[model samples]
Target: MGRLIRPDGLAVGERVRFDGQVRLVLAVTGRSVTLSDIGGTPRAVPPALLFANGDFEVVDSSGRMPLPPVSLLETLPQAALERALWWEGHILEVLNGLPPDAEAGTEPKPQYAPSRSL
Candidate 1:
């Protein structure tokens, strides 16, 4: 097998194939890549599970995944801070909810859903 691609080099939304199935790259780390399953929950996987040559595509949302406009971030009232905190907390909850063996054969729970509005 060829050397695995480092997860840091990948951008969110990139599509990659492994074990004859297709999954989207959701996040990256020095030693592993996180992929979104059919329900959109991210699962971290080691580089060893990734193949070198398979169908891959970068999932660009164009402006859909655009950075939060500075104007919006600046105009928020003090109360909005709570909303931001809530959002961050939700993200952490999702991350924490993932199975430790998500990549090893423990399938993701069907009740989990990826946060698309983030």
Candidate 2:
């Protein structure tokens, strides 16, 4: 038996060792996992049998996954854009004592006046 690793967290393409052999993970579903041997022979087994008593260990982690990109905030829907703009204005009012689009000579909001407690 090998040291325990989180089998449920295994990803396709990761290499794991068990039964004195190293296999490449092919797929992981809710019920079973598919693995392939070095000869390209495939085996499907229940996670329970494969990981019984922690009989498996991750040998290679070259399949590490990356988080998806979410750098486009300006593409938000109209409602989300409005809400984001409202929150930005509110935050700017609180931090700068004036709304983000306030005119240069406009007076600060009474509740967020910079002359007050800061």
* Top-TM-score structure, candidate number: 2
Score candidate 2 by lDDT.
Answer: 0.68
Q: Which stretches of candidate 2 lie over 4 Å from their true place?
A: 1-5, 63-118
Q: Lowest-lDDT window of 10 residues in candidate 1?
A: 61-70
The residue pairs that clash in candidate 2, if any, are none
Estimate, for each residue in 4-118, the C-alpha lDDT of model 1 and write its tens digit: 4534356554566665566666676667778766644567876555645353334343322212334544658878855765565454445544433345544434455444332
Q: Pick the candidate with the highest lDDT.
A: 2
Candidate 2 lDDT tens digits, 1-118: 4444554488775787877787777788878878775545578877777786355877876523221112333568978876866776686678678876898899986889987785
In angstroms, give how far residue 19 of model 2 lies from its true place. Answer: 0.9
- What is the Cα-based lDDT of residue 5 in candidate 2? 55
The C-alpha TM-scores of every prediction are: 0.37, 0.45
